[model samples]
Target chain A: MTEEAPAPEPRPAPGLPPGPFAGPAPAAAPRQHLIVVRVRLPAHLRTLVQLEKETERGPGHGTASGPGHGTGSEVTLELDSPGTQSSLLDALETRYPVLIGTIRDPRTRVRRPFIRFFACEEDLSHEPPDSDLPAPVLAGTEPFVILGAMAGG
Target chain B: MSTIRVLVGTRKGAFILNADASRKSWEVNGPFFGGWEIYHVNASPVDPSRLYASQSNGWFGQLVQRSDDGGTTWQPVGNQFPYAGVPGTHQWYDGTPHPWEFARVWHLEPSLSDPDTVYAGVEDAALFRSSDAGTTWEEVSGLRRHDSGSSWQPGAGGMCLHTIVLDPVDPERIYTAISAAGVFRSDDAGTTWKPVNRGLSSESIPAPEAEVGHCVHRIAMHPSRPDVLFMQKHWDVMRTDDCGESWREVSGDLPSDFGFTIDVHAHEPETIYVVPIKSDSEHYPPDGRLRVYRSRTGGDEWEALSDGLPQRDCYVNVLRDAMAVDSLDPCGIYFGTTGGQVYASANAGDSWAPIVRDLPAVLSVEVQTLP
Candidate 1:
C-alpha cells in the first residue's frame, strides 16, 4: 500500500482571514466583568456571618472599633458576570460560606420555605433563580433583601 | 483548680454557664446564636476548648457551629449532610412509605479520644460522623440501611436518632438510639450495625416486642462499664447488661415509668438518673412536682430527689438530651427543664437548685469538667 501522505495542516475556511482570527478562534479568555451587588441580610444571618468574620480575624480583633470595622447587615459582594439570583447567591455564599444552606437548600438549591428574597420592592423568591435581578439591585441602588419570613410564634 | 462549664442549648439560643469546682455561683454567658434553635451543644472530651453546637431554624435549616475557644466565639463549619444513596424510605405516621428527608440534628456526640472526631444524630433518623471536627460529615449508612429500617416510624416528635454512646474501652463499639426505631449497636465502628432492641416492648407498635420499632427516648452508659446501658424508653425504664443483647424493665418504683432523659453518674457507674413525666401525652412531672428519680443501684429502685426541686404546682418536661453529669468529687448532676430553668445538684442528685431561671426553654444540657 502506498504510504499515506503526512496529514496536511487543516486550513481555515475559504473566506476566513489567515491570521489570529482564522479558523475556530482560540477560546477567548472569559471576559472578567466584576459587578458589586448590595445585599441586606436578616439580623440572625448578619450575626452569623459577622461571627464568622470575627473568627477569621482571630482573637483580640473581634470588636476592634474603627473605620472598616463591624460587618453590618448590609454587605457588598463582588460577582462575576450574569448577575441573577443564582449568581448573587453563589457569590454571597462564596464570601460567607456559612450561609450556604441558610438562604437556599444546599441539595435542591430551592429557597428555604421561610426565607424570602426581595429587590426593588418585588418578591423575587419565586422567580427563576437564573433570571436577572432588577436594575436597582444590579446597580447597587436597592439592595437584594433576604428576609426571614415573619414565621413561628 | 477544677471548674465546670455547663453548656445549655435552649429553644432560642445557647448559654454557657461557668462555675467554680463548688458548682455554685454561676456566671452565665450567652444567648449565642440567638433567634435560632440550639438543639445540642457539646464539648470535646479530648479537647475541652473545642465545642460543637447545632444551630438551626425552621426557615434556615441546620448549621453546625464550632468553637475552638469554648463558647467565647464560634465559626460555622460544614452543614452539608448528604445521605449515602437513593436515601430510601421509612414508615410514616400513617404506616405509608415516607421518603427519608433530613430535617435537623438532634444530638451531637463528640469522640471520647479524638478531638476532631464527632457524631451527629439527625432527624429522619440517621447517624453522621465528622472526623475533621465539624468541617465535613459522612453518613454512617449501615444503620439507616438496616434491613428493618423501612419499618421504622416516627414518634410524636419526628423520627430522629437522638442518642449516641461511644464505648470508652472499645473504639470500634458504638451505640445509638432512635425515637421509634429502638436502639442499634455497631461493633465495627459505624461500618455495620444491628438492631439491639431484643427485649424492648412498645405497645404503640403493632409488634410490641419487635426487633425494632421501640421509642427509645434516651440511653446512658458509664465510661467504666460501657456494656451496661440505661435506657429511658417511651413508657418504661430499661437496663441492658450484655451490651443490648437483651433489655429488662427497670421501672420499679418510678411514679410513672414514662420519661424522657436518663443519665449515668460520671464516676459511679451503678448510679443512674431519670426524670419521669406524668405520661407520654402529658409532658410534665407526675403530680405537678418536678422530681428527679435517682437509682443508685442502677434502676428498679428509685428515690425522688426533690430536696431543692419544686414540690408543688411546677410543671416542666426535661428533654431527652437535657441531663448530664460532671466528673467531680461529689459528682455533680445537672438537668434543664422546658420551663426555662437549669437545675444542678452538686451532691449527685441528693438535692437540686436552679443555676439559672427564666431563660428560653432548655433543649439540651452538657457539662465539661475543665482542669
Candidate 2:
C-alpha cells in the first residue's frame, strides 16, 4: 500500500487570536496603593531569600529617589500605609513567609536573640510594637534595618 | 507500582528522597528549612500529604511548621507549648531542683487515625498533645507531674522526651521515653502517667534498680503487635514482650550495644535493627566500621549488614530518632549519620546504598510508603 503523505500544518484563521502560539501576556503588577519602606537584612538571614528577589518596585516608588536607592545594602517592602516596626515586619512576613520566626518569635512575638532593629541610626529594637517610627523611616527616606548582632568570638 | 518517600531531618535542614519499588534511581529534594536544626519530620498516617516539621535554632528558639501538600509549602502554626498548670520543678543536671521550662521539640508523633491530632515530646522532659492539627499545644501535665519527675535528672543531653509511641490497639494508652527519666506510659489518653522502668537498670544512677533515671535513647514497636516493644537504652538493647511491664537485655551478639537509634521492620514484627556505637562517650562505630546489626529473631541473635556501607574510617554516630523503616515488599530500612549520609537497604538489610551522601548531619529519618 502506498504511504499517505503527512498532512500539512494548519495556520491560525485570520480573524481568530493566536490561540496556542501566543504566550501569556506579562502579569500586570498589583494596583494597590503601596508605601515604600526600606529594610536591611543581615547576611545570615540573606540565605532565606537567596532564591527569590523582590526587584520589582511597586507603583509608589516609580521615581529613582525611592528609599534605600542610595543605600547599597537595603531591601524595600511595600505597605498600604506608613507602618511601625511591627507593621513593617508584618508586611515583610507576608511577602516572605519563611522569615516568619527568623526575626521574631512565632508564639511570644518577641524579637529573636541576635536580631536588632535600627531606624534613623537609632536602636529602635526595644520600642513598643505600636510606636510610630522615626519621621525619616515613616517618610520612606531611611531604611529600617534588621541587624544580626555580633555573636560568637 | 509503589512509591517510597524517605524524610530526613538534619542539624541544618530537612530532605526528602523518593524512589519506586525497584529501589533504584532515586530523586532527592530538600534542605526545606535551611540554616535551622530540623529535629524531626513526620507525615500523617491517615493522610500522607500532611506533614509536621520541628524547626528550631539557638537564636529563634523553636517553631512548628505544617505542610498539607506533602512538603511543597509550609505554614508556621502555633509554637506555644505551655505547661497545663502550676509548672513544677524537676532535678537538674546538678541534682538540684530547677523550675520547669519550655524547650524545643525533639519528636512529633502524628496520630494513627486523625491527621489533626499529634504528640510532641520536648526538652525539659515533658509531653504535649495537639488535637487541633498542631495549631496549639497543651501539656499532658500528668507526665511532668509524675511522682518520679522530681528525681529525674538530665543526661549529658538535656532532659528531653525524645521518643513517643502511640498504641494502635488502645486509643487511651500512650508511651513516651525521656533522655534520663526512663519510660512513662499513660492508660488514660495522657490524663495521667506512671514510670515503666521496672526491669531497667543503669550503673550511672545511684539506685540502678530504681523506678526511673534510665537513659532510654529510642523505642520501637510493630503496629500489628502493639504490646511488644523494643528499646535502645544507654548501654543495652532491650525488649519487652509484655508491653513495658518487664524488660530483658537483648544486646547479646552485637559488637557494642551503646547506640542511639533502634527500629523494627515494618513488615516483620520479629525483625529489628540497631547501629551499635562503641560506647556512650565514644559515639563511633566499633572498629571504625559502620555496621547495622539486624536481628531476624527479634533480639539476641544478630547479623551485621555492610554490603555497600563504609567498613573503615567511618566514625559518624547515628543519633536517636535517626532511623526508620518503610513498609515495602522486602521491607526497606533507612538511617542517617552525624557525618551526613543517608543509607537505604531495600531488601531487608541484606544490601545497602546511600540515597544521599552529604546532607547536614542528619538528626532524624522517617519513611512513608505511598500507593
Per-candidate TM-scores read 0.89, 0.82
The candidate that achieves the highest DockQ relative to the unseen native structure: 1
Candidate 2 stretches with Cα past 4 Å from truth are A1-110, A119-139, A150-153
DockQ value for model 2: 0.10
Q: Enumerate residue pairs that collide in model 2.
A: none
lDDT, each prediction: 0.85, 0.81
Share of reference contacts found in each model: 0.77, 0.23
lDDT string, candidate 2, B8-35, tens digits: 9998888989999988779999778787
Please write out the lDDT profile of model 1 over residues B161-212, one tens digit for every residue: 9999999899999999998999999999989999899888889888899898
- Counting clashing residue pairs in each candidate, in order, gives 0, 0
Residue B334 CA error for candidate 2 (Å)? 0.6
**Top TM-score model:** 1
Interface root mean square deviation per prediction: 24.8, 24.4
